[model samples]
Target: MQPIVHPVVGYLCYAGYVRASDGEAPQGELTVVAVFAAVLPDLIDQPLWLIGVTPVGRTVAHSLFGGALLVGAVGLLARRRGRTDIGVAFAIGYASHIAADIPWHVLAGDYHELGFLLWPVTGMPAYSGVKSLGTVGAVDITTLWLEAILFVAGAALWWNDGCPGVEVVRRYVG
Candidate 1:
């Protein structure tokens, strides 16, 4: 998934979950955590891949193990802080990040790339990743179309939820 799609899908997923749970709009704190969690895998793996420890984008941090660790850490912190709701939302976002990655790989015809989903359970394989970050932002056939679809879905959901854009940022994301 594109970088933007990660957070957008995560936010929308969490927002829908919240709305379905009750009649309240998603709170700013949950939005912040969800967005952060959505991108956390990339933030962790990208730097590691640059340093040459991991093979590529879908290694280590993109694994289920990585998602569990993130969720465990956040869940523990939220528990200690007496904020289980925060923990739940964080897990939802983080899990969605891991889940969103699976289909993107499949769609791109990178079935083997999904080995990273298992990580330590399977030995890491070496594959050359894109040499430039520009590749992601560039007008690629696969990602561009996928991104368009995801963005439309995300925007529609946000608009339906009353477009809590700046309010979420001001109250929490900032």
Candidate 2:
């Protein structure tokens, strides 16, 4: 998925889960946390791979083991700080990111592309020789269509949820 899709999906997932669980939209601050967590895997892995520290863009941070460890540690710390909601939001966002990456490979039956879920246990697939970050931002037609669909769905959901987190960004920016 493109970088933008991940966070939008994360927000959609978290907001839907919150509304279903409690009949209340998520708090803006925690929604922000969820959005950040959604892209956290790529944030960790991409830089390392770009710097030649990792063999692929999906390494430790993209693995189930690594993700679990990160979420668990963060959850525990959040609990200690009396912020379990923030922890849950983070978990939802991170899990949504991993889940979002799974479908196309599963549909294509390219199970090997999913080996990164297990990291060292299953090993990551070979890198595709993509050297520059520009490749990630480039939008081909298929990706553009998918992104458009996701954006519309996410926008509707965000509006329905009272546009949670918009105030947070406005505050930071202004």
Candidate 3:
């Protein structure tokens, strides 16, 4: 999945959950947290790989153990701060990222790509044909189409949610 697709999918999942459970749209700082969390795995792993700190793009950050530890620690901290909602949003986003990376590979029985989910317990296979960040171009047509569709769906959902974070962006960017 493209970097752009992750946050959109994350927001869609979080917003859908909020709508289903709370009968309301997600908004405010929690939305920001969720969006950031959506890409946090890539943010951590990519840099480490680029700097030669790790041998692959999926390392400690992409592992189930890492995700569980992060979510648990954040949940406990946020609960103590009386903002469990933030923790929930973060978990949803983080989980969405992990979920988004799977399915296609699983359906194809390419479990080697998923070894990173186990981290040290199972070594991450080097991505076929992807050696470095500079070599990461040329997305497949099917992936492009899927990304476009997801982007449209996410945009429509955000608009339906009354563009929750627009004001924050406007306030900060302007």
The candidate scoring highest on lDDT is 2
Model 1 worst lDDT window (10 residues) = 127-136
The local distance difference test score of model 2 is: 0.84
- In candidate 1, the residue pairs with backbone N, CA or C atoms under 3 Å apart (3 or more residues apart, or in different chains) clash, namely none
Better of 1 and 2 by TM-score: 2
Better of 1 and 2 by lDDT: 2
lDDT of 2 by residue, 1-174 (tens): 777789999998998888899898887899999999999999999999999998899888889999999999999999999999989999999999998887656544567888889997987887432122223456533434656699789978888878889899999999
Candidate with better TM-score, 2 vs 3: 3
Please, what are the lDDT tens digits per residue for candidate 1 over residues 31-68? 77887888888899989989987767667778888777
What C-alpha lDDT, on a 0 to 100 scale, does residue 71 get in candidate 2?
96
Which prediction has more favorable TM-score, 1 or 3? 3
RMSD of each: 5.0, 5.4, 5.0
Relative to the true structure, candidate 3 reaches a TM of 0.86
lDDT of 1 at 70: 71
Query: How well does model 3 score by local distance difference test?
Result: 0.83
Compared to the true structure, candidate 2 yields what TM-score? Answer: 0.85
User: Model 2: residues >4 Å from true position, as ranges?
Assistant: 127-144
